[model samples]
Target chain A: MNNPLLSIQSQYWAVRDYLSPEFVAAGDFLTFKFPVWQWEKGDPSRARDFLPHDKQYLITRNVPCLRRATAVNYTDADEDAEKLLSFLDEAEEVAGPDGKPRGDDDWVATHIGRGQLPYLRITPLPTQPLANLNIKDTADEQIDEIPDMDEIPDMDDEAVGLEEEDDAVRIVHPSAAEVNSTAGQNLLQVRTYDCLISYDKHYQTPRFWLYGYDEPLADSAEQNPLTPAQVFQDVPADYAFKTMTMEAFPHSGQQLASVHPCKHASVMKKFIDRMEAAQPTEGEAAPLTSGSKKGKWGIGGMVRKVTGGSAPPADKKEKEPSGDGEGSSGVQVDFYLVIFLKFIASIVPTIEVDSTTATAL
Target chain B: MAPLQFQPLSSQPTPSFWSALNSLKLDKLKLDDSEQPMEAWLEESREIHDREKGGTIGVSGSVGLGSGAFGQESGERPPAGSVELKGVFKNYNTIEEFKATETKKEIFNSVADSILASFETNAPQLDTFLLVTFADLKKYIYHYWFAFPAVVSKPAWEIEEGGLVAAEDQLVAEARKLADDLSNRSGALLVRGPAGQRTAAPVKDATAFFEGVPSSERIVAFHDPSHLPDAPGWPVRNVLFYLASKHGLSDVTILCLRSGSSSRIGRVSLPGPLSAEKPTFVGWERNKIGKLGSRVADLGPMMDPARLADQAV
Candidate 1:
């Protein structure tokens, strides 16, 4: 279809609707295959010693389906500073065991973790059964029978004009063209937080068990590997989970510590609201579906008209529709995951500490 | 301090601090009402008779009235469930007085300063909320996130009809994106008019107003219902409760409404993570509610964590 000059939000909804449940669920690590990056001498990525196999580490266990290659890259061309701000805004400000005053013990970690393992409490993604899927259908059989774009309704115009100030939704997901753009090549692998779910017996509330790691990738000269102890210094005293304690896993053999609770559920609920707001309204027109279009309004007809009455290139016309065939769900799941992580990052306990202070020493 | 030691879930036997407190038998007083039924009556009689001579009790009054010396012969009556509060009407009186003495700019500055000052002192460390009501002719709602400077923030101190709508839209957009981020959600509420001016106001539609503001996740709402005209005189207690229930919030730190007549703000029961059965209520200036400064941290999730442990197990 002709590019409808869709805004970031419109694009986000298109991508969300384009995905099916099976594709989102397929984001599990069992079937993940990493894309090869350019190797350089003395690069940290060469550190095979600390690199745990995919299954061994918690970060890689539930790999997000959307990779840098498949997703749309929305980073602005101008303002590298703004891009960095976005990164810093969304990066987990963890103070692991590596920073400041070589103390007898790390107070920051102990204070927040309530134990050796500091939890990263993630809000679970909202899961809905596919519209066409049935319980009895086999996975292989159902994959081929996914619905056409025409079947899905568009967002309601009234919903778009919702006067609520809280209706703003940011689209961080990259589209196929955007991802392939020149600016997308240098993008860094987004950091994934390591955490386990735990419980606070006193309040009887669920808690995140933060497990710190060095960095996102092995090869990176600019980034510093964060020790588990270093992650706590950045945590503010008032975060909700900062006051929780959890039972250590059977094999961890870690000591118990006090916790400082952070109210992360509030953050999670906000994400849930955003997803709710982005939902497609009933009876709205499907913008890109050819079946819904008439005459020259169709993408092919529009492309033909643009090409000055000459036939459009066969290869260009053959390019499958925006969200169809393989990897669309992977793209969708990855996009949602990124959004979730960004929301999670915005609330994580990260208090700025002055390096010049005596406390740092 | 020594490092806290971790133990496996199966091996840990210590009860949580909350569980230990709950186990105590502090519900009923040691002395029963039946045991001390007449004990209170005897103490009261002694006080009346123990005074010095010519204490203005029996010297000027009649010595005989029926069988008793004094006319107040009936037994003490039990306390009333609710009192006839000098609130909405009192507030109206106060607003009139305020308008007579203070300019609109002064009222705005004082109200804004009161709210900003509260963020440092009265505000809870987490999940703070406040609602400031004013008696303005134009009905506008101004909101701010405490993380930003209270002054020069969007929907400035001055009341603007267009700004109120713009502020609502901005808040809704931010709330949608950030969800519960402190920088995006926690802030003040500036409502035009005092508690009683209910007709044709933006805030009359409780659902829309409550939903528009970040009531569900706000840590503080600086309420000042100062200049409401023709009001029925009801406190903004119902609106506060509505915001609390939206997020299933159990604990919230609210600023009591200020009256034009009194310098002192009304009292609100700032409880320590109160149970749902006993909700927080705002009291009049003289009749303060719960204890002062019962500040609490964010209570986190509403559900029991034991169920989560079971599910994980």
Candidate 2:
């Protein structure tokens, strides 16, 4: 841990030994063929002019993954050719059962594997050049109409000199700081390191260990890069918590119960007071319950039952009269006397009765 | 020679005595013949007799000789030759003496002169004269002169311890009698009289009276004590009294003839107690013809009394 060089050397050895058989078999297919033209000499006109068809052919050729420290000088033209031949040798070892050449699978295993190959690193080109394409003459010209680029200053480096040196090794075991920084910039780059591996059957290129990375090509431009949890803190507070898990309930049971007792007890007391105030005074009976025997009739059940039973019993028997016979007889006599008096009065005038017996006497 | 009874000498020719006796007979005959006859000889003799018998003569003498002999007498006289010669001789002298007297001619001349004088004083003078011929003076007297009462004086019976009663009293009596008579006849009374006199009677239907006068005659009514001076002339006074009585109007006005400067007429308004006191003089403001004459030509026709009374009531 004191020196990371040893760990980097060990990581390389492990990758090499593990891939030696496949590498030796890849070497058997190696051929020292020059490119149709050399583009590294700065004679762009004499170069092969890799049109879209040539780029496609190169991608399908199943080139091998080389130990970039030993076989290639990334900036040298001859070294790039030797590394390309080595990639072809490794592609031949992982040829399919049909055995002509493994196509893109062998090309991916030998040259594009995560740990074993270091022929090329695809770093993103600076986007500021394209954004500032309208800035003429090194962006320092002070023409009257020139836009104020200070409002949008360029941050890209002026010169990034990438040189090929013989001691420069492609270390598969990068420092954690480097890994974290690069992975923080884009999740796909981190995910590519974590999930991609070289296969013996397709030793020339790296294949995605997890199929999740094999997204539709059409959606690639519209997708947002994955961000870490720490980035969420920069969003507005209200929205920040909206995505977080709830910690605990905001109210206790005792507090809820206490509120209910006062509210519900007061409501019940008002209901009882309303009912009592609505009741009728003494000597004023409640209205008859007309539809069903529910409240009023149910309350007078004993009186109704006794009256019902006594009425049937009295109906069966010829009961004695309630009042005295003398009083009843007097009432009968009074009734007859009124009728007799009315009749007698009506006939008295025509009867010619003696005056002594008449009421006028 | 005692009263000279000369006998008729049949043997001797006695011409002088015969001529004298013939002259006496002619005078007697002449007196009998006064009118012209149809025949020429009778006409000539009648003219001669007319001249001799004061221009008119009454036939006289024996009935037979005086043209009474004819049963139906004509206006003609007998022929001169038909008269007895002796009758002619006796009437000839009488005719001469009758003509010399001229009694009838002289009486007519006096009457005519009196009439002409009255006209000069009373009537409006005319440029052209008109002569009215009457058969006799009695006819003129009956028709024009004495047709109305000679003087409108109160009746003798109306004198009650007085000199003269008021004209109104007489007028009222007359109007009442008229109204009574009119009522009896089923007609109305129309009294047109002087102004101060009652024009209406106290009858059951006594209505109204209107004041105005007919314009032909000149009248002169006077209320002032002083008589009008003569320079304005008598016609002015006459017309004044007439208009005052007839129309119950007052005020005097004069007009002159357009044809002559000296010739003029005058009018005076009559007064009426029952009429409007102030009377209007309707005449031309200026004498355009340089003569003082009234523009008022004539009063319109008189209003019917009964109709006027009906309107008043």
Candidate 3:
């Protein structure tokens, strides 16, 4: 499965399908069990068959977004300038000319400003039923079981409803202390986005599609399908204006905001190259997941170990697996989407979308 | 206490809804600009937060699942019966067709006529729906508007002393269970008697339910979409009009049913119950800024081949 001969499209599919032997995410709170990215065939009712059957999309749901993107308090990752420069200087001496760009794009998102919100309005929910119901099931069940509501105007703008762009509007939940005292109050109105990773055949890289369900949408008591304008506001301003486009969901045809895939491959190539250049560690594994240089202590000396071939390759490598597992051997093309999502989390840093623990590299 | 204010439901037609309209035009109704039938429904309001007390509010209840909502059904669930109300879709052949003052007036009149018909039968009907659009198919941009014609009562109704109070759990549970049936789902109910001794029956039985019971015990319950404690969803307002016009009853109790989980019963006494006259209506959903203009959804960025081809990997 680690064959260097497969095309990038096949490689992306391989990563999604493979049950990684090294990925023992069982007890890890930061990650899902295994096979983090599940493959989907999308809607069978699709009139056109433009994309391949199995690789149509990839999804990971119920990602929690705790605070508004505007509320994010970020400390610049550029703070440790000296440590970052030396790591790049080492890559420059080892990988020759191409190493300079590797450190720049992969870590810049950690320093970026980001925020999130989908439309919300409070209408008192029945207190009892929501307790035993699974969040996902409750949403689907109410569509079938519950009756439709009468048209009520949105009058109390302040007491209920999330402002599409106001910072003064804070999130409140029934489970939160004050409301909890009154039992049958509203549930925690947490804004959670159902992050969907779809493969856009046109761009040929893994494309991203996201649908945000409000607490009511999540609870199945209301139908506030997010608008295209609301979806744009959830993403960073830079990406929203430039790279973001409101595209129809390939399966449901509901319009959702998707991150344009034209430049995804180029940025992904940086991490792959960085992984292939550094040698397999024998004793303790370094946390390459760091945006900083904490685990890169011996990489310069390990660089000359005749690492087979640099990844993101026009040139191929036939390196054998150092199968003791624990990612002692760096970078399998199988870890692409994990790394892809890491890059995505950078720009749209507000959505806590991934739990894949990008340490798979 | 303050007088009650009615919240209006704004029609949120998804991009899929627009895409479906685009397809319906291309494959099915090419040149025909006549009305096409659609099923649109409303959503319930879920809460009344204490800190931000709305003196009264209008809950935007309708989630108009238009043409796009028809065909694609999910694997886990059957076709949804979600607030299945009749929606009349009139796609104007051109923007001029949409802009014609007479055309908009005629659409409004058609909805008004339906409200009159519902009042005549005293039947449970959510027949009030009107949608007009001009879809620029080639460009993938859509211009559309939805009109929920709520008949303006001659003398707007007022709330009685003592604001809405939570109905007993037993009645709420009974009303909720009956609501699961699609037939019962659209109609209002009459809950008679005190908490444990109450009997919940459809509004069709209001004549019998109120026969022996006092006006104090005969309470009306309908699905509400407003969470503001002061307001009930808009459908009940028409029900109020219907009861006034048909039964000659002006004073009654309204159990503002929020979702199916709970109920807030209050007395909304209307004086000089409305008679079936050519009903005057007042429901044109305000736009994002509370304006009376149509909204345009441009999917050109995603649909235009030129844009997709802009960046070649």
Best by DockQ: 3
lDDT (Cα, tens digit) per residue for candidate 3, span A289-344: 33112222223212211121223311211122212122333444334555566567
For each candidate, what's the DockQ? 0.01, 0.00, 0.02
Chain A TM-score values, per prediction: 0.27, 0.16, 0.50
TM-scores of the models, in the order given: 0.19, 0.11, 0.54
Error of 2 at B93 (Å): 99
Worst 10 residues of 2 chain B by lDDT: B140-149
**lDDT by residue for model 2 over A1-361, one digit each (tens)?**
2222223323323332223232222221111111110111111222222222111111000011111122211123343234334433432232212322222221111112223224344322324532243243223224411442331112121001111111212111223344345433321111100011111222321111110111101122111111111111121122222322111111100000001111222322332232223223210342342211111111111112212222232231222121122110111111111111111111111111111111000
Per-residue lDDT of A157 in model 1: 24
Candidate order, lDDT descending: 3, 1, 2
DockQ of 1: 0.01
Residue A302, candidate 3: C-alpha displacement in angstroms: 43
Model 2, residue A347: C-alpha shift (Å)? 99
**Could you say which candidate leads in lDDT?**
3
**Per-residue C-alpha lDDT of model 3 across residues B223-244, encoded as one tens digit per residue:** 6755555567666766776666
Lowest lDDT block of 10, candidate 1 chain A: A352-361
